[model samples]
Target: MEFSLPDDNNNLSLTRFESMLKTNNVLFFDSNEFENIIYHYLENGKISLAKKAIKLGLEQHPTSTNLRLFKTEILIIENKLEDADKLLENLHDLEPMNEEIYIQKANVLSKRDDHESAVQTLLIALDLAEVDEGIADLYALIGMEYLFLDQFENAQHYFKKCLEIDNEDYSALYNVIYCYDFLNDNQEAIVFLNDYLNGNPYCEVAWHQLGCQYVIVEDFDKALVAFDFAIISDDTFVGAYLEKGKVLEKKKRYNEAIDNYKITLALDDPTSFALLRIGKCHEKLGNDDLAVQNYYKTVHEDPLLDKGWIAITKFYNKKKNFQKALFYINKAINIDGDNVVYWKLYAQINHRLNFIEEAERGYKKALDLGNYELSTWLARADILIALGEYEASILNLIQTAEFYPETAEIEFRLAGLHFTLHESSKGHYHLKNALLLNTDYQYILEELFPNILKKPSVQQQILNAGKTEN
Candidate 1:
């Protein structure tokens, strides 16, 4: 009833079955043909047609276990678990050695969240399974059951067992790595992968996994070597190239990283990640033209790539082109209006362009979207102060200080705000605390509070703090 369609020849069978159905001669199909027709419909997600096929198949072959099993599977899909269980139990009594019945029963138990019972049932299926045909699949199912139970070590053991049976089981191998990651046992993963590589030296996936583990442990040198081996094992491995680029980028080898990223472009279609990295490397190397070119290409390739827009906006901001930066950041916000980072960037650009009201509104939007950065709060406070809302600015700085209690800049700003509002005592108190936190922060007083710093009392207090620090 549930047969694997391993090759394109199954398409021919499906076509012929469709022809029969169109001619209204589906009744002529034998049990195997009818099962194939039912499976074809189910595989294509045509459940109604599959149900009709199953009914016709049962009418034609009244005692067919395969057709009955297919009906039970349909029942399970319909959430008729009780009926499915009863039918599977009857099938088990009729054919005690049939592995599919046990697998089906395990499926029912799994759906019911009885994973332990499911594992036991799968074990029974394993015991009766033919060695060459279904053993690997059984091992995989047991591994999944253990994963469902959050028993990562047991899952890893069974997945490893699957790999031993078929060395090409990439899914099982990846699951083993996932288990290691869940346990935070990268060293054990390294050791196991080293052993795996000893026997399977040319497996690109194993080498890639080994490289990832090395990266996790911050062993970039070993990671580079592993990624090199992955590329050597499969010359067209785009993942190896991309990961190698990342490690080289981490080491500040920008040119080498670009080379690896370029190799991925040659091996496959360009990805936003690779293009963005290449753009960043160019930006780091001071190749502004090339950086802008790649950034444009990145957004063109993926209009929704927020980072691409961000990179372009930051580039323009660095060049003191506030208008251009605002343009690109607005495009980014249009694509994803709720992104906190985009809103923050928009606020900063508006602040640079002297649009105080828009800047304040942008800052509020960013904070509402969960941007709690100290710099964001400080920028908003600056805007409030510029608007002569001293009390509102003080409230903003106080909220920021609550989050970053030890930051001298916030205290200095708060001191300046209190001085502006004629709260002399509070101003002196915050100034003393700011000097206690960072004595040299007085150097920014002219920039932050030029008018207040000119007062003799404030100047004398700063001078006194400087003498105390000395």
Candidate 2:
């Protein structure tokens, strides 16, 4: 009932010389020529020739998408973007019910920076495209496109329509939930999520997301309720118990979190995340030996788990066993070979143990990987300040100030560095900036400022600013 042409490689005159078109003068030549001419022009850098060929060609087959699409590309290459867009618009009008026409038109609109119109056009095509697999893929494609554009409402509507026909469509469900989260409509998400879970109760991922939503909203009891239903629906769902353990930990129910983690470990694939939580619970309960055991279990189960090594290293670090901390951190580096967070932790521990060159190398590796967030830089500055790399520490703090601008904490550190260098004017400037932001900021007010106060009158000077601040 439908017919289209094969993609012939050569030009029309060349194809006429070929065997297939030898005696088929009636064959619709324009249909197969668009891709060839466009590619030929692009590959050969014959832009003007390509434009001329595509222009005269499409006039003969204006309704042929294959030809119109070719002319559109040629117009784009020629920097006549509006003309290219008008061609797609004309094609859509000529083939208003054609799903491919809608898709092509949407693509042109997207290139023209008209995302809202593109989404509306695709929304209309969604109903038309639902019956055909080609159309369904197109709808899914545009749904995801709108999601990338952060058009949450359109993304949700299109994805929901996609699922109306294909219930098991994973992209639709994933995008719809993403849209809900993006739009901060989690409360609204709950009503329909309950519907998704009713028939598809076995979807552990969906249940976990629902539980997290409840946790984010501070509804711990509901989070526990959701997790309980998740495990009942699928006992082997590792993420459900692991995330439930996190929620329980947030509620300070450390013992109960441990139990949930234990059940998760009983499953076939004991997750490193679960094992790490078990270690943390034991550590919190003051069972260092048990904590160490679970930490090792996590590392052995998945050596690539940086959290596992960090847990063990942190336990030893807190106990002041620097040697053991160093050992475990080294093991972590071997596992997550290029991971900067591991390297940063390793650097901090090395600095604690007075291994200067090793610490420098570790810090350098972390910084080189573009992992120098404010916290990482601040910690690095602490190590530098210890080594009397005074200028380096100050510079690191300055970089950190970029990320934490107008924050009193960073200003206080800047003041500390300037004071240490005996530049009181610069130090006072930063200290004053710190007070302007938060006059009562603990470290700045209590520790740093007290040592620099010329007289007891400075406390009143700062308190007066806090009067109008909050």
Candidate 3:
């Protein structure tokens, strides 16, 4: 499609137009130039030119259904959905058998959130013609829509219809898997995906989905095998590698998990999540140095990644390296100052350094931040006891008990405090509870509180207290 501009001598001819279009590739002077014009207008968003080109093309073939589709496409592209619908309506009247026009209208309505109208339009198109491949694809599309809306039954109906039309439709198969998974029908998803893969062994998506379903069902061994097949089928598949690494981690195969993560990073770029997993595997394997190094890689790759810094700080702090732990913990605080874990890590490092004042303030800060979890509060209780603020420790312990009545640690610690202060009755009461909950802890019974074990009167008190509490 080209437009003719006369030469200086006022002569217009095909040879000149062809030479011009060839030189510039604009095709400004061809009889069928409307197609090239519409394409250029669409690619560059030249709406005015697109309209003019549509008009020019209609002059050549006024009943051209393809040109009408082009107009509808341009309108849809410009988000003039109403205009597109109107144009599609005109085309439908001209050619009542154009199933594609109905589909286009359905698409426009679906985009506008009119699912009912979209479904009806497609249904009408299906009624008009049953054995169309396009209708099968439309069924899959409607299934996806219903899936997103959490109408699993409706979605399954459409997806099954698509599979009935074409048993090998991957989109329909995946949709069915998704719908089942959404409904927490992991067993159903497993059966379907397994059957689908048996028929289509080369379906990487089905294998990947089957592995994920296995994980959801807590069948890690089968998950590993599925992901193994998934990765074997496509070595560059990042999703399979990641899931395989997770299965390995669940199986406690830390080395294999790290290897999988390494390959995932090599295929993709180094991600903080992968690095964090690598660090965790090392940490579980008791390679503190490698864990620390990998954690550093994670945080270094994304300086603002909080978990990586947290993992690094905790690993170093647990290893009794206060300085290194402080470095990463402080880095984490700098990244997420409001995070309770970051402040808790800071307090831990300070405790290790015997910086009582700093540790106290750090713990107090964490408490101030509204994280009254038992672990943080218990640490506070211990710190208070160390500082000889026994009253504060007791109060903190009581607060912890309110949140976790089943826990024995809080009561046991409270008993130790009361015993230290020689409050015999209260001490006996708590100690009896500790023993009842866990009689196997002989060290607490013997070494930690020797007086209670030796004194007959105190033993009697413990028995009375246990009887009363029970």
Per-prediction count of colliding residue pairs? 0, 0, 8
Per-residue CA lDDT of model 2 for 381-422, tens digit only, reads: 666766778788788888787877897777777777787788
The parts of candidate 3 lying over 4 Å away from their true place are: 1-97, 160-170, 266-268, 333-470
| Best candidate (score: lDDT) | 1
What is the C-alpha local distance difference test score of candidate 2? 0.75
For candidate 3, write residues 1-470 as lDDT tens digits: 12233343223333443354456443434334455556656777777767766765776767777677878887886799989988898888888887778878877988888887787887777776656556777787677667656799899989988888777676787778878977889998899888878877877778899999999999998998899888877889999999999889989999999999999899988899999999999989988778878988998899887888878777777778899889878877877888887888799789889987678778878988887877788788878877988888888888788888856777678777787788978987887777677644435545544654666765675667567757
| Candidate numbers, best lDDT first, in rank order | 1, 3, 2
How far residue 131's Cα lies from its native spot in candidate 3, in Å, is 2.6
Lowest summed lDDT across 10 adjacent residues in model 3 is found at 1-10
- Order of models, best TM-score first: 1, 3, 2
lDDT of 1 by residue, 1-470 (tens): 24665547567666776676788565366787777778878878999989978887888898899999999889989989999999988998899999989988998999899999999999999999887888889999999999999999999999999999998899999999999999999999999999999999999999999999999999999999999999999999999999999999999999999999999988888998899999999999999999999999999999888889989999999999999999999999989999888899899899888899999999989988989988889889888988998899999888898888988888898899899889999999998999889976775567868999999999899889888878
Q: Which residue pairs clash in candidate 3?
A: 1-32, 1-33, 2-28, 2-29, 2-30, 2-33, 3-28, 3-29
lDDT of 2 at 92: 68
TM-score of 3: 0.64
